[model samples]
Target: MLFRQLFDAESSTYTYLIADHTTKAAVLVDPVLEQVERDLKLLKELGLILHYCLETHVHADHVTGTDRLRQATSCSGIVPDRAHVACADRHIKDGETLHLGDITITAIATPGHTDSHMAYLVNDDRVLTGDALFIRGCGRTDFQSGDAGTLYDSVTKHLFTLPDETLVYPAHDYRGHTVSTIGEEKRWNSRFAERDGRGANRLRHRPSFIEFMNHLNLPDPKKIMEAVPANEMCGHLAATA
Candidate 1:
């Protein structure tokens, strides 16, 4: 298995490139539109064929590169089931696995940040937590049908159930961190856990978590007006217009 984490500094988005070393079949997860050339170059240089372009949800941050990439290659565009992406070649459901040679990517339904979001587990060793769980914080539950309590449940029950040693690769990072383990996040992530008076890490209560999230008052993403509608059309901006 070959894995590469690519970043788009403008949106603080992380686009993942995963491939099977034996067959050279590759998939790009959450790719940004502005970075398509770079991704294509990398794939060409590595002698890999782009098999799929996967989206976790309809993004409200930056436009996706799936449409552009598909135009350039023979890759299929895949989005999470229930996503409003009509142009998607396929919609992946929770627990559904896509095989790239020996590597398997399974989708985990985690809908809070967005009503139709997914977090993918790769080969049971690493998880690509796309906008659902970040390095130390989680996505804001203030829009796109987002709910604080639902987000809390998704993180505490669904994500936290993974193996403690499983590697967590988020879709975006604003704090210069790259990767973290499930145990590390469960113990230290302030959004999910906090240090008790006894100096032990404990999960934040659901009600409290909900209250905290509701009060965050985060501003909308800069590109929401264009990104959301465009993403719904599988990243073809003109289609939504």
Candidate 2:
């Protein structure tokens, strides 16, 4: 089991490279468009053939490089069935597993960050927790189909049930922390701590949807409306005329 995690500073997104040492068969998870060149260069240098490009959810931050990577490497793009993206070759549902030589990654539906969010559990130990769970906090449950109460349930019931030592690799982290263990998050995560009434609960005072929308600082996603249709259909822009 060989793995490398890459971070995009601009969007605080994390892209992962996991490979089987014996076969050099690899997969890229949640790749950002800006980093595609670098990612491909590294993969080529390592003598690894990309077998799959997995999207945890339809992103709202940066454009994905799924189509570009597929064009370059002829890799299949994998995404959750609930996501309406245009480039996926395989639309996986919960409990479905993808195999790469000796490695098997199982998908687990974790729908709080988005309606189609998924957490990929590798060998039932390491989890790529998309935007669902972070080191000190969780994703904001105000976007898409997000519901705070539902997020609470997803965290406490689905994710927290993993063993304490299971490593958690989140989709984005601006703080420069690359990875965390379930035990560490369980003990130190402020969001869960607050939920347990052990500390200050800032989320308790959050405004209603209308009021929250009024104060949202985020801009509309770049090419989101366009990306969705193309992504959902798995269509890529042709490189040549």
lDDT (10s digit) by residue, model 2, range 150-235 = 66667667888899899999999978788898877777776664343665333332333224433546666565565544555443
Highest TM-score among the candidates is held by which one?
Answer: 1
Q: Write model 1 residue lDDT over 1-241, tens digit each, in one string.
A: 9999999999999999999999999999999998999999999999999999999888899999998899999799999998988889999999999999999999999999999999999999999999889999999999999998898888888999999999999989999999999999999999999888999999999998999999999899999999998898878884334
Report the C-alpha displacement of residue 121, candidate 2, in angstroms: 0.8
Residue 32, candidate 1: how far off, in angstroms? 0.3
- Candidate 1's TM-score reads 0.98
Alpha-carbon lDDT, every model: 0.93, 0.79
Clashes of each: 0, 9
Worst 10 residues of 2 by lDDT: 201-210
Instruction: For candidate 2, give the lDDT of residue 177.
Output: 88
List where candidate 2 sits over 4 angstroms from the true fold. 195-241
